[model samples]
Target: MMSNRWLILADDLTGAADCAIAFGRRGLAAAVTWDVTTSGDVSPDDSRPLPVLAYDADSRGLSASDAAERHRGLLERWLEPDRVLFKKIDSTLRGQPAAETAATMAYLMERTGAAFGICAPAFPATGRTTLAGHVHVAGRPLEDAEVWRRDHTYASANLGFVLGTAEIETTLVPLSAIRSSDLASRLARIAEGGPGVAICDAETDGDLARIAAASLAVAPVPFFIGSAGLAHALADTLAPAPTGAVHIPPSRSGSLIVVGSLAAASRAAMRRLAAQDHVVHLPVSPDTLLGDLAGRADLAARVAAVIAAGDDALVEIAIGDALDMSLGPRLARALAEALDPIATRIGAVAATGGETAAALLARFGIDGIRLVDEIEPGVSLGLTLGRLSIPVATKAGAFGDAESLIRISERLRAVRTQGSFS
Candidate 1:
């Protein structure tokens, strides 16, 4: 058996939830936590010796050097003999992936005599793939995607160049080689020889599975890196057993869908959800919530009233002409303050954007989340842990299509808000 206690470290909340949910689905008691001390929280019911622990470093918005330093420190503390470490990076290659992954590799090498990182950042469910070291989206190079053009700091989509510039020694495992059965031996040799990073190519979910199985076939398992796809594969190979049934209580109130993302996919989904007849739309200006106390109060009351009326409500931050990136944290805090008073009345929540979800959970005093299911490719549906235990659906800002929000709202309503109203 390839059983090992798993520790997943991610840059943001959604990444943390999605990656952790992989293990959760495979019968390992898994929880996602964001702690100032970098320590993780376990579920109250979990008594397993090595319950899966996924931590969000919240370093997506930090500088490369700062992010790298944070990961190095975290790795030093999380290193354990019985634990398997997996660094979770965005499937689309967002954030300071190069810096973070390199830092993880460096720290692992120092802690263990021999360490090799096998990184395959492909999540086929969401149309992300790697071919010949270059990351692509929907068959096009990532540079052509809207997200890359608007927010990317990298000059190219090639993982080699990205990691190379960060001074991380990496070798590419191409598609042809990845499909071969000898991959396990190949990876094992790299792990025993010296410190090196293997950036594997994966265009489909099967590729990720093969890579994961091959990597595990080795004696000393290599440190894995990727998104939910790789995490799911690892869980399948190691924790392949059905623990039991997951009980989710039905909700007596309508669900709340919160949108704090400015990404095009999120904005489009927001609009689609607003058009639904069963859903009520409540738009709050980010500036008004952050600056005007009266405006914030009025908006909160309106949102609360809508939820109280047995109708699903879509609360979104209206994007205007310009977005002030510096006010991001402040806006999240302000929104959380406005919504905190009525959180209990809202049965379930579907939040888009990581910072938004993190802020709201923190305001509610939630320390961790026990993941239960994935509504879709990137949407993680789970129950909060600690202070509150309401159902939550977390989605990354740049993921999903135009109708994603509507689908999520309907699912939450069915699972939580629908028949319980009686």
Candidate 2:
């Protein structure tokens, strides 16, 4: 019952919501819930559209069985094909409650027979709202300001659990890493300088009012919710600004880094283009950010130590295609081809045009084996010779597990737009 279709069970409500938004964008009707307090409810149709549901903030702390039963009711209500049912839970190996979250997952998976995946995103030694919230990202002279930044806002690192009765397996790798160029570019574009608008949870209805206010505050170019779906929704909900386009007015944004998954990064970049006509080819990755054994000590640990100390660092690594290309290429191409074998293939010679992506390359494969003599599939390398210049977060493109790629991509795009560093 659970092996055929794709079932996605998000570890946390936000993960569920975000994954649903991803589905909605693909034209599939989906719903997401954050409040997990009580089990029985149609879920909130406000923060999200009908196809996209959000849990009431108050209903987020229910017993696992109770929550699971309620979710069953919700799914029974939405008995439509191509419809998604999500339950996000946090796990505690040491405790039963979090494990109860896992119980909720087990129930949804067995009952719905939906194909899904799970993601748990947590920042152990990081600061502020480790997961989801406003992050006052500053670089260089702002080390002392992180305290200020945290005071001003926080982020949510609540576990992202995505599960469905689908074939997609959940393999989450904690890769809180990104390229420098990617990070720097991200900050610049997002702030766009001056008091820009901040759109919170635009994936839901109440968020619309929030955006309206944000628009009023920022005027015209409202800073939209970070994810692509919310951005699209905001653009649709608001009257086309005088920028002349149905989209947010184009910005003379400096540069932006497209991090995370290539597909997500590419979509984020494409969505934010005020000047869509202007061809902007952001660099993408087909590897891990903190994957495999090498990443832990290789890049992640090194960067974590630096940033924790309030120092800056930046690391660069080369990426290419497989079959005479690079390993990331081989893995990316394999996965993409599996998703859709009809994808076009580039020759062994030149770069695959200016714009390269993780997803598109995933048409090939994403798993590369590492051989000391030769860096092949399933292999990663690290070099830490550079000065601790800027508090840097370096990760191989393939570091994060499968489903997390989307969120990772969103984060990368956000950081890139913020242009915090360069």
Candidate 3:
């Protein structure tokens, strides 16, 4: 059960980075892939010694069937004899967790003759916890959160009900049992009992630690299914020791901030970051970027010029009074395109939102990223793979506090002054 190889699959870039950071924090070399098409070009042996490979399936916006199929294919291609499988679900359950988990279960059963999956999506550090089989955010039901309220497909926050719809059998491990001395034996029994998913309840890091311990103690190591929280617990118990302090040399120039998420938190953070005297705020509207090619070019030039002048630039998608969900993806791609002209000039790229980060990095031909640090509970900082070696920071659209953007900007600046990404 104690192995360094891990195939961590996530639905998007942010999810991939957050989960991978759990291992990186433990001193294990972890990388989050951006493009799956070129995944074959890199082998597990080709990466860092005993590396943790995290792939972004990019299936968040796909249909349940498509997402499931995508994960199935990934498992077929990447799952190896010695590698452990970790399916990273969104902490807030934003993606098709039940369908994808079922897909993972099917593949694991076929490949390893395993029949059970240990499901624990609680990320206590970010206010996401599970209790009595339901997922809660900040003490409220997940569906009650702004993200789910705006766009949700699940009938309820109950993990059992959600997975039941996908025909994936599940069992709940309550907190009471988790805190008890018999917890380890209970989990071992569950593993030996049958093939199904175990939905574990956890309100704190301690609960997750117990679940992880019990999992490893079992005969057949169950497939792990959860967010960064579970990953953290597993990393602490299973991953190798750190090589050294996690450090990335600072950027030589000012950093670039791209905000394309429509989440209220992102919008508010941009406002606060834009007001900083040292920050140069360049707002890009979706309409102009989509329709006005010349104007888009002009904006890109200005953003590049500002960075060249050693001034940090905040290039954000302009959101109007009316709420238009359709504009989100388009604006994300547009903003990324506009910044393509100055990708190299950017000392570091700090993006908010998975779509935005993916679009922007793909433009620069970045195929993957090596995670090295965690800026906060939900924010991960790393260096881009392939041609670009610059430090990069990624945050989920709805994650982080009001000053998250500010904190990223400051971190990048500190690195810039430090000389090099270690």
Choose the strongest candidate by lDDT.
3
Clashes of each: 0, 116, 9
lDDT per residue (tens digit) for residues 209-298 in model 1? 899888876666678889988988888887465666555666667788889887888999899889998789988887788789889888
List candidate 3 stretches off by more than 4 Å: 37-50, 239-251, 320-322
lDDT of 3 by residue, 19-74 (tens): 88888887777888856565533443375454578888988888999999999988
- Model 2 TM: 0.23
lDDT by residue (295-317, candidate 2, tens digit) is 32344344334323422222222
In model 3, the clashing pairs are 27-242, 248-421, 249-420, 249-421, 249-422, 250-415, 250-416, 251-415, 251-416
lDDT for 187 (candidate 3): 80
Q: TM-scores of the models, in the given order? A: 0.94, 0.23, 0.94
Ranking by lDDT: 3, 1, 2
Q: Which ten residues in a row have the lowest lDDT in candidate 1?
A: 35-44
Q: Provide the overall lDDT of each model, using Cα atoms, as 2-decimal numbers.
A: 0.82, 0.27, 0.83
Q: Per-residue lDDT for 213 in model 3?
A: 84
Clashes of 1: 0
